[model samples]
Target chain A: MTTQDTTYLDQLEAEAIHILREVAGQFEKPALLFSGGKDSITLVRLAEKAFRPGKFPFPLVHIDTGHNFPETISYRDKMIERLGEKLIVGYVQDSIDQGKVIEQTGKNASRNALQTVTLLDTIAANKFDACIGGARRDEEKARAKERIFSVRDEFGQWDPKRQRPELWNVYNGKIHKGENVRVFPISNWTELDVWNYIRREKIELPTIYFAHQRDVITRNGQLMAAADFLNIDEHDRIEHKNVRFRTVGDMTCTAAVESDAFLIDDIIEEIRSSKISERGARMDDKVSEAAMEDRKKGGYF
Target chain B: MDLLKFFTAGSVDDGKSTLIGRLLYDSESILADQLEALQQSNRKNDDGTIDLAILTDGLKAEREQGITIDVAYKYFQTDKRKFIIADTPGHIQYTRNMVTGASNSNLAIILVDARNGVVEQTIRHSFIVSLLELKHVVVCINKMDMVDYSEQTFNDIHKAYSEIATKLHLNEVTYIPVSALKGDNVVNVSGNMPWYTGKSLLDHLETIEVNEDEKSPQARMPVQWVIRPQTDELHDYRGYAGRVSSGSFHVNDKVTVLPSGVRSEISRIETFGQDQAEIHSGMSVTLHLKDNIDISRGDILVNSSHEPIVSQLIEADLCWMDTRPLDDSMMYLIQHNSKQTKCKIREILHKVNINTLDKIPADSFQLNDIGRIVIKTADPLAFDLYHENKQNGGAILIDSRTNLTVGALMFRASVE
Candidate 1:
């Protein structure tokens, strides 16, 4: 406050923290959707800023796909432990095991879309009235149209047409029984904003974010990290490369970019000059034109 | 870099989305994959360039109908500033959506078609921007190529809009001639309009000063939550959590909790991992008070000297948003900042004709109708006038039964 200058990251941080507090001020039982990705990691820090000395009014919840990178899962655990916050992870495999959701098959099939079912089931089990996400509007076209306090019906369906007008900083979390809200505190932050903010905050992430030598399969001019969770086709060839992930999702879907951005500053510089979008490397978005919109209509965060 | 939040508003087919696309495209913000998708969509123009309007039409129905139904936010950063563009729908029915978009923006881009300069939609959109008290207005006379980029046409349109700007009391209005499609004077200087020597649209945008509302004199913070770390190490901690809506607050500054009229001194200002002696507008920080006052989520902390008006009956400009219309017979929830209270419409003043800006007698209010009304809240709301201080003046009407945000209200003054 003493300085006359407040950077854009400071503005974004304040907005995100204000939203996090609104979720706490209104909802009785809310949960932070912690994916341990860069966005979610930033959200965790904002939550701390919002309610640190006091415990986070809600617990950190993760809908683990089980096919996630071991490094990401381990990093998530460590961060949660260090913050002394409770974490409740709902695995996609459990949903499959309980006959609640069918496991997808095929080489290109992924548990990414199946996360919606597991997520809704987890919400029901915990009776969470609100679930905060790290979804940014700049990532996708459909996401750009979503509200910060995205209200979903009992079936977790989004009615884009009937979305309420979000005026000023005032958010209305009013919902009847069997309804929940999916809050995105970082809806305004772009990919570059995230990297710049991460660098400024010096937040730590999994090694996957930084460059490392990993076994990857070349697919459609992109590299997919080689993992046991993925099926190796006869046409696919495994090769070792120094690559890092722009977005860390299921190994079956997330593609890595060849880079040597071992530092946060390096990643920021690379992202500044990069032409392809953050989601461009992800295989899940390449399914169709309205793929994200269609999934969101059916309650896929 | 600083952030500038702005919205684009114009009539249907006025190229609001295309203007945004052109800005992003010409700025080199468009990604390669995004361009590839646009190309593969096979929706190119007659000249073989990808129709940039398709970039913002995110929904399937929107793309199929070739119209924007809701606001699509696009982000791009130049070395000077980071911009958040709220590409809003331009249809008359979606005026509420435009109001929503403009509510959070400090500047507005009012696009006017060169072929039909200063149309009815232009007046309506300008009225909304004025009502919202946005300081900066960039009247981009779009589709200049259709008019051969004639300086005569630009001057005529600019002269016509100057009258409207004066009538609406809109300050800092800038007129630019540009063809968002032909890329004339959008990002770079155009040779078509050699008579015009002013900066291009993006140049003006990148260098223009966005007079922030936070520069207002009054400091207001509606307490959103109370943080008390109940532990042996920090047992006496009681912080009021909220964002500084305007002005600034410093340690040892005397503040009054509204409605209760309790006084307290700021003991500490706390953010994430650091403590500060002061907090400025837009900074979401926690303030510790020397005295434990009766402050809650609905209560607001205001400067004691320049306190806002506290009254149950308030006059405001109301824009009816719901399809069901405004039913004055039932109670509604007036949500102002962190506070929500039951309220009822006491009386309707008059409905303003959006096309002509004339106040006419109207008893019934329908969707997208802007009118003046007197509202009676169950409890007094401490706030400033919408024109004087936007952050403290805005409120929303939520239908008590349906729980839908039925109206957007900007407070004018206390109803005598």
Candidate 2:
């Protein structure tokens, strides 16, 4: 093989593709959790690589929070149609209406924590034994301790202290009835790695990732995108500026970073020299230092 | 960038958390607001000191006691590489937790207090690390300030650790002296000890080789899942989905499905829409067989000419992970490679005391004890010696009642 052909990226790409196939091979019923984010989008591309020219062995499921960027919604719909793959969505609004969950109310209330209810309900409803996610450990503290085939109690809660020991590349995905495993094929990939892969592969993403003019206001020291779900007071004083989201989540919770990088390469360069973490722009994590951990234990993806 | 995974084993007071906190802090990895909160929390405690360890030990009890009680993970990156650090507790009872943390790690950082020299816990941790067969080990003599930057002290600790290292089989051992509380020899080389010449902890980590065993002798791929596309575009496409456990495979390679012992030629190796010439360990790929093979999950695909031993009676090295002692008559699930079958403990040959590395005859195995056992599976299993190939030789014992993984096991030395 040529020197350039033996790169680590090539190795990682091959590994992820293998895992995507394994999920299809192992479980009785399995599905991919598509969030319309870059990580999941990369997963979609990997899925296509694993099983293309043929429908995916398993359907793609998205736990939809009614409060999402319109661009993401449009992009998600277009991708599903383009791929001609089945798209299953579980809505948080439905769960709330069904009294399965009650929306949080506060100055920074968001559907971030409530997504767990909808996600678990969807899993139980579909009887999916494995729900493949794009969650990378480098993204958060609690997620760093997760196993690739993380076993969840029948209740869908993750016990950080009691995780099964995963050695070498052997993943034990065994579980009893009513139990499920949350598999993360890209668990080893970092945010920078994700951006670099996106640039190298030229993967398409939502427009919100690139720098654009948006009406946003400063709240809790973060630039909150002005959306209908957000309770923006008259005194908040919205201003048009060039900003892009570091991450996509419940529209009310995710914040934007001021940047001028509009292209993938430029964004990669920006991330290289950037000082703050990718999740720094997300307001939801600011609820508390252990906010993500708390949400994950309660079954949040 | 190179992907590196490492584990940190040190006492709660050995400044492990602080060392990790420094890496996160100096790399500009933490958010500005999070740093602000950390500073605020430091002030809230108002102990007149910066508790950098708080950044890693993020549990309620840990925060209250100012110590790590469980294995916590942290990730950071430099321009050269990306690192995943498994910050494990140093307490003896948390030994099981340490094993969980080190199982996936490519290297281990065993921190020692320079002033205390090599303590019992240090040797215990090192022995466990060697027993786990981790390729790279870095012995960090921490708390250099406590010894007033004495090279003699650093050398003394290093010399003591070298003897301990000789007792166990280890490869690629390096030593560094640092003061985690003072942020020395962590992200930057320490100027206080100009006499010491070596790369900083991060530098050695950035350049260390990982998965060197990827090119080892045995080739194994345990089938994780099977994909069959019965659609119109691809009506008769069937592929075996799995990660290459060890070695590599290419298109047209003659392979066999284990247990079933069905021979087939690799028609194609596909990932996404692209077809690759070959695939290796750590890479996930799907294989298409030339013939119709009735294969499913829990099956292994091996080179037909280089098949593994398929046997019903075998010996295995077992690490009991359950509270309930292992019973010879009890039937448990043996998950070896990708295959799962009913099995019973035929006999307990002996148990190895992890502390002294000595074996004693025993009728049963208990929690956290390593022992040799003979087991008989209902179905023949494909396995290689654990010393020969970790991927194919190792397996987990699952309880029938709670379905909990009760033990981590390995292939035992054959008496034949």
Candidate 3:
């Protein structure tokens, strides 16, 4: 890559790398929030760059929904093994069994919101003072207000009004005992940047990210795959289509996009020309305008 | 996309939140659920007109009063640039919040009501923007539609603001008239303003090259943490972990660790699991030294030839953020980079009259006041003039008992 072309991306990468090191240096216990998505996967690569030749400075924590695509889980396991980093799984299913959370009853109910509880519980139990996430600001409105070192109160609530003034490269990670900061190293990156970085780095990802034939049904003008958690009525028809996921979340809510781009170069071209946003096909955010904000304030990653 | 960090300043009725909400809405950055919440909140109000500002001013009290209470950061990106927008409140009482927002910004967007034309708050915001040394400033005369899109009115407002702009002596200044409520000259070029030939706000934002000062002649790397295990696999290992604050460092560079006045040579710049050829500001890496020196957290490293001033006495520009007035005789926790030491306030030189851009001589600094002050730290901290090196010349003052960050201090000059 030419130096000029990668200047902006390199600057962003450098800033992210700085924040990652800060998390390791400032906090007593820190973890990388891994979701097997492209953004988090990109974060994993940056983390590797931040601390390599040795094991990761922090462990990888995944808040499992118990409804993930098997391909994603397999990819997650393989990535952890390849990097030789410790993985800690916090299960929403266990939370449900313990009555910490109640599963919603509906045709398209998701555990996406419920994961917030499990995530907070994990942080409190593990005494993690900082959790570095893969969230990008271009994804949502509420996320746009997030600080690189976002402070959460004792109740795991985000008070946007009183966040510390983050100036220059100096991030003040000072917080009270029970309060923790949600560190987002890639806060300035966009979806296209993530894809471009992946392409340049030749990072490995789940096979579901590429085009493949899968049985899916059209819902809400978006195509969703057939899965165990997804309920299909008798009249609901499923068709085989060449599709790929623009984003990977819980299986019930994330919709696949119609595409034939199997390679990274082709995917980059498709993204450049695509009119719809990355979150357009995701069924979860479509529930309401402030769904992400509400979830975020309640400690959702 | 290139990254641009900016701050927006406007009063309650200047439509700051609406402008941000419109940008997000027109760009399709708002999620489906967030749009639903906006609708639901509007429905609950029983008014057909959707309060677009609710998209940004999310607090319940802010919704009730229709004013921003504090600084809120918002992000959005176009084909060319990614933006980190710090939306600060307009109320006079929240000027400290505005200072906090503008401190880290490379650019500032100061919104003025077209009909009002450079009111008291406009001058106040512009003064603070200038004080912060923000290179680029865009003066957006909003609500032009309310004035029938008159070119004469726009010129009058622009002329009035130019006088203040001259007093501030900013690096670069541009004026644009628009109707934030009607979406003119924000994301797209407005057809109504035919007399204006300049680029739209988004166009300007996309092309403006932000001069991020990462390269400096005097290098500073404040040690944040020390990595020392001396494990069986890796014996005789001592690395200083910190982000490069300024300048560049190469292997075998003669460096001196501060606070202890110990000297050493750089053996390696470790990052990404491998030794790097060189390292610059904003890159966090571990430094291996040729000679093992006694260095720990709160110690700074610098070039031996170009040494920074090591003194306990300092004169600095202070932005007091706490509600309580700073105690002149009390010792405050002075934190510069990762170095924390006790510093007692020697005296207050002068306080800034933000509305007039005048320095009023004062004996003490109060809440939300910008002033010049003298401080004496317990230990000598290596630093330069704030205008020369932002990394070494700045620090934060915290109350010893409360541990609350009270003021941000930048070295004005050395106390000779």
Candidate 4:
């Protein structure tokens, strides 16, 4: 008998690696969805473990909202360069310019929803049979019902009612032409689990994730980063506060929380005691009760 | 902290959702934002308290129907253990959903309303739990407050359930009385039940010793993906990457490829680009064999002396999931572990009536039906019995036309 005891994190890592390998083996053309978030970053590491010593079977794909933080873009580029893998950027601005989608005009206007159009366009154009994502079920109630290998129709619409039953570790990635599967390797992980993994693996993230002085404004009781693209109302007061983002998304919708968790361990400790969910700070989900579900049904990553 | 995966099964109004909500609430796993949203929603119970069932019924249709339709996963953690709860629907029509949720669970929590005692739903759930080979069973007799927290009611229900459990081969059953809405004996000990003395539901979950079956004597590793660098620096790399399904494999262990029976020796074990002396079950790693042989996905490597049964004929118990009845003439795709092969149902021996636990002969199976069937596959499959090793024995049937999973299969035995 082997004397090694498998820890919880180790078991999770194994499960994720197993899923990643299954995707690589099953799909004809697969791509990793890189969002420059901690979950996606951990996914990159797991992919490295799954197919390191060899190049990744699939290229890394990112949907560029054009409202992303500069730090995240730079970090994404450097990581791709270091891994010597290809990166495909699907631009939402390009979709808007091509008249594929209209831009929302308001104080809380975000290109987050428009990313779906560009994403579906890119998937169809590239003929990617499967697109691996870093979505975790513990994040939201809607996602909790998602299968590991979630199948989508040719129109990129998700049917929550008609999902395939995923039994054991065997995943059925079989899909007809024009249909694709969204593979989530870390579907069972929690926010604390992700942070603990990042800390244990010494993974590097963008500086914006750590506590830093940033110009932020309060709106709808959320701390929004005062970026150049953000429209500031006349009554909004901007202040430089020491805050860190619990999640990273389009700069327009993602919100930050007041924290001094400069180090990864400190961030892990903070998340362990956090009363707010990781998605609670995001402004986009607050738009409606089933905002995430609606976006997912429309093929939003 | 340790990890425990459990599933809850009970009929509607049996308080399955309320029980889960109570656990999350008492553990402080429910976030403040979630609590606020629940409070502000108009879907409150009659007592003006926030509807805890709404917390897990995420879909709009589920809320409109006021009953869970599918399996929803919920996570929470205490100081000692992290738990993943698969809150499954209790309706008889959603038995397939219950099977899906209980497939990966180490334990099963069957909720029985104290007022109703042991209903047919309880027997059906316990039967499925036994069929799935779940190790632990917690029979939570909920709604004690409605029964006036009487010890007599608890004892009567407990005695009735013990008889049913014995017939279902559920020996590790634990009965507890509780009121999910009142938070009695769920997360906290109840002062109303002075005659009862036992650990709370959360306390038992926190400290229960999960005894994993001893690793199978034979090591089974199904090749998930073959990693061939083909790079200049690692041109000779031909690594077979997979998770160990059972037992352990070490360097220099004599291994044989299944279906082809190619023999080789493990030269090295690699994990995250580092060489390891050995790899155990549940750990995904790449292995370098001493001799190169024709290997691909769907092939398994095992100890040379302990090869699995490789046959095309198999006997299995299946749970039909699709609305359309399973037809014997149609060919379906049977996916076992990493292997996918075309298969046809050869025969339906008998169907087990979940309510009565009787074996009834049937020609076809409808949705939510559990039956024993014979399968003939085009290719040989190397597998173990479902009672022996779950990872290698479980399989799924996908419809050829719709490409949707139609049924779940557990290998019973190899047919001659």
Candidate 5:
């Protein structure tokens, strides 16, 4: 083995691993919220480092928005199969069928916001005391002020003003029976840091993360993948373009960036010099300046 | 390249947000979309530039109030090094937030407005940096343009701060004149400050060697989880899972499980399905012991030679975070590393008056109060002094009823 000093990536990985173990040790019933995104995939790798030679202390739970990319769902299944871990899926369609949430009706409608109800339901049904997510602080401004172990009320609501102070490396993961905590292991990692870590670990992701030929339509200056899930106007012109996804979510809301950066190295370079923030590709955040904060306070994962 | 995780202590009035905004903006870390949004917003500088503070005032309430209420972490990187800034508010009531941010920082950036040299707020921030024992301190004398770029103004503040630094025993202090609003001495060298021979803030930040690699020689790894795959292929595979907080652990090393003090030998060190002869600090790995004892979660494994002090009574300094005052009768749950146990405040020594460096005798502490207190834990805790080893010495107090973290404890010693 060659000797190399610990880099920033290693430091981040170590911190994340420590956090994962803390979740395991603190909570009785914890779940990993997986969306098959690059961030969740990174969390899966960290969970392996945190708990190996033993079945994971918790199963992976996915709150399916039902408008998700088919690639992400398939990738999620196969990855869980390979890791020999359990996966629990909560579908937004089921929540709609049960009258727990109403489906928005519009050409720009999306099931993204509706996923929070399904997620909260899934948590209560499973009695999960802690739900570990791949939320990063650098992704949004309100998230920048979040604690590593953020406590949520019985309704899964986040109170920005009433957050507990996180000190040193010591985390206090105490909650009532109904109250739960939203644990973010990668709370300190930036988008670039996540990309660099993916490169270093050679972590494989869904094919959509890399560049490929896809049918797309430009709407509000965003190149959206022309999927059936999205309400495509017949008069809208669909164009074939080479693009990759900077972030993965509901196909109706997630936008793609025009790039030929198929390889991980190329993707890193593309992200390094890219002018637009990664969340700029998402249409949901375009709704308002405080869209993310509002959703978070309303129990959006 | 390595990472520098520093804490910046200042309010918006001192141009702290402007300095941070300049660092991120000039480094090209702030993307076009964010900048475009800022430009589109109504908030702007007096001269019609985008109000950079708008970018960091994250919460809507904070934005509406024109003040920071909590600690916000921001990350930016240069070609030389990556950085994580624990940006905290510098208000008198926000001292707890500063303590929270400074606990994890290797360096402190104390922003001082040139017009108001050595103010009360300056002394308060300095006291926190000193209390946290941060080795590297950078005193940025900001708003140089407002002061007409006067070298005398900078020198006067520098001299005034030097006296404070000497009293606080802040090591490796550097003073730099900056105009965060005018982009002077922040990202690049400013032509206006020709007499200022020191490097710009960004340059100094990139080149400073914080020596973060030099962890304490004593090994400490709090056992987080146990891996016992009952599958056919890996039976009898009892592995202790934990991250090495300090020093290193190697195969055949004599180890002792803390709180139980059971002696054992390290049989194997494994990480990511590979066997390793040794694991260093900041590594997440599992170890197989030669003789399995009654080791449970929250047990710390250490080198047998340098055992941690195990005791039921602890003398510590607590920075209160909760709005509720300290109730000695209430049983608080103390979380140290992965361990959790009930604790109570046995005695209150005194509260440190941050501005005056005076220890006022007190028996109670309210929000944002820093005071020494003795704690009685339900179980014996294995730990070191906070100054000697931060990883094992720091803990958090959680209110049993509210389940909110109420105080941050930095252990001084174990008492009878």
Candidate 6:
């Protein structure tokens, strides 16, 4: 036996793998929530390390808002195919078509809030007892108060005041019928940590994460990706800009930052010295002060 | 860079949140948008200063009530190391939250109000820090500016805290005079306090050596999941997966499964589809034994030479965290690592009043009460003492009816 020094990244990875294994071990039915973003992609790599050689004990679940960047969906499909794992997608458009949720009208309308219905429906349909998410506490104020094994009621509501006390490394995953847990493997990780881990592990991400030329329109001082789903008015001016997304969400709500960070190293450096948070460009959260908390209480991942 | 996790605990008015805000602000860890939000928030102090407490009190209810309801985890990093700060609440009712925060922390910062000196909350936090067996503690005597940055006030508070520390068996205690509001002696040394000679709070935190406890030399890996690929390319692959809880396991090392006491030799160590010669503590990997033995989740794989105690009856100290008191007639689920079993509270030995550090006779425990109790389990469990190894020794009690985690238990001994 020799004394080995573990780096900060190694420790974080070890903690995440441990959590992933715990979710697999404790819950009878678990699924990894894949968003094709760097965080969830890092979760995929960690899951591979957690239970590889053998198939993942759980499948991957993705709630498609139908307003996502096509590149992200393609990346998600390719990764799932490469891993030889099952991917379950719950489409928000189906919910809207089925009258389960109503699509918002006019400007600032997005499928972001409607994703909660699709996600909850998917969880109930599949009876997933635990859903592994890539949410980090450093991302938002509401996230900072969450437990690793956050339990949701039959209605999929998160009661912030009544969270289970998580002690040591032991997470209490015990729940009755109809109750499910949201497991966050990287709750302690920050935005910089995720980018650094992606850089270290050389995990592939969507091309949109890198600086590329794309048609964008400025709204409310934010650059929104000019996608077909986005209802751009005749007065709205569209321009092609060299930009990259800090976070990937519904194209209607997600915003981009001007940058030339083409490589992972450049992105890591950008994050290390960047003034804005990863969630700063997220237009959905700008609706209210407690927007994330309100959405989380309603089962939005 | 290395990682260090610490938590801060003090009374409501002790400026715990302010100290945390100062740390983040001084380190440049607070982002521009977050700072802008803080500045724009309606909640402001009387002095027109941005209420840093709002930064940690995330929930609407907490902000409305001007209190912290649960533990809020914050992350930051310096050039030398990364830090995870569990900014726990200060209210007495939120003791469970503080316990949760302190359980995984390597160090604790117990804030002391210089004007008030050592109070009941300070003693309570100290007892919790000691009860959790944290290796390090920092007593940041804050609000020194209110006391005119006087060395005499700092010395008086230090003396009072040292007296309380003696009763709590706290050996590693560092005292620093600080004013969280004035930003004195928090991140940088204070020129005002010329008489005081010690590292500032942040400087000390950056330089402190968090030595990892020596591994027991006996490996313990609780089987978390069993993997069988059953692939066409590889016909038969049976692997037992878990994180190495303690020590290290080498390929071909003789091991024994707990309870069943099945013996086997490690045939291979696989991690991420690659075989490794050995794996150490905290590494999550799969192990394939040479011989097939009945192994399942909740079973522990230990070095054959050093086996843990397997018993049905155990005595432990439990911190009750539920509204309803512990009932002797009701059954609770005791979960240790991956193992789960039905347990009954045989007897309540004693409960300790954290403020006074006195053992009081009690039949049942209510919210935020720590008590020693004897538990009788339906089946035997493999475990080590909490002081010996935290990962293997700690357990939680889940209410069978509500399914809420009610108590945090640390095994004291196997009741004969």
Clashing pairs in 1: none
Question: Candidate 5 on A185-208: residue-level lDDT in tens?
Answer: 999899888998888888989999
Model 2 C-alpha lDDT per residue in residues A1-301, reported as the tens digit of each score: 3122345566667667766766775688999999988999989988887776557888999888999899999999999999999999999999999999898886677888788889999999999999999998777766766778888889998887677766555566778899899999888787877888888788889999999999998887889899877877777879899999988888888889899999988888888777677777777777677887887887877
A265, model 3: CA deviation in Å?
2.5
Question: Which portions of model 1 show Cα errors greater than 4 Å?
Answer: none
Q: Evaluate candidate 3 by giving its C-alpha RMSD to the native, one decimal.
A: 3.7
| Clashing pairs for predicted structure model 4, backbone only | none
Standalone chain B TM-score for every prediction: 0.98, 0.94, 0.95, 0.98, 0.97, 0.97
A1-301: candidate 3 lDDT, tens digit per residue:
1122325677777778778877877789999999999999999998877665445778999999999999999999988888878999999999999999999876777888889899999999999999999988677656766778898988899876676666656677777899888999998887878998898889998999999999998877888888868877776689999999999999888999999999989899998777677877777776666666777777777
Question: What ranges in model 6 sit over 4 Å off?
Answer: A1-3
| lDDT over C-alpha atoms for residue A269 of model 6 | 84
Task: Mark the regions of model 2 whose C-alpha exceeds 4 Å error after superposition.
Answer: A1-6, A103-109, B43-49, B232-236, B414-416
Tens digits of per-residue lDDT for model 2 on B122-162? 87788778767788999999999889999999988888888
Rate residue B127 of model 2 by lDDT.
73
Q: At residue B306, what lDDT does model 4 achieve?
A: 80
Q: Interface RMSD for candidate number 1?
A: 1.2
Per-residue lDDT of candidate 6, residues B325-396 (tens digit) = 999889999999888999999999999988788899998999999979999988898998887877788899
> Of the pair 2 and 6, which is ahead by TM-score?
6
| Candidate 1's TM-score | 0.99
CAPRI-style quality class for the chain A–B interface of candidate 2? acceptable
The residue-by-residue lDDT of candidate 1 on B1-416, one tens digit each, is 78889999997689888888899999999999999998899677789988999989999999989899999999998989899999898888999999999998989999999999999999999999998889899999999999988999999999999999999999789999999998999999999899999999889888988756567778888999998888998888788999999888888988889988888888888886578878889999898889977789989998777788999999999999999989888899999999999999999999999989999998878999999999999999999999888889999999877778999999999975
CA RMSD, predictions in order: 1.1, 2.7, 3.7, 1.3, 1.4, 1.5
Q: Worst lDDT window (10 residues) for model 2 chain A? A: A1-10
Q: Candidate 3: misplaced stretches above 4 Å?
A: A1-6, A218-221, A233-235, B17-66, B69-82, B145-155, B181-203, B206-209, B212-215, B225-241, B269-277, B324-331, B358-367, B399-404
Candidate 2 accuracy as TM-score:
0.93
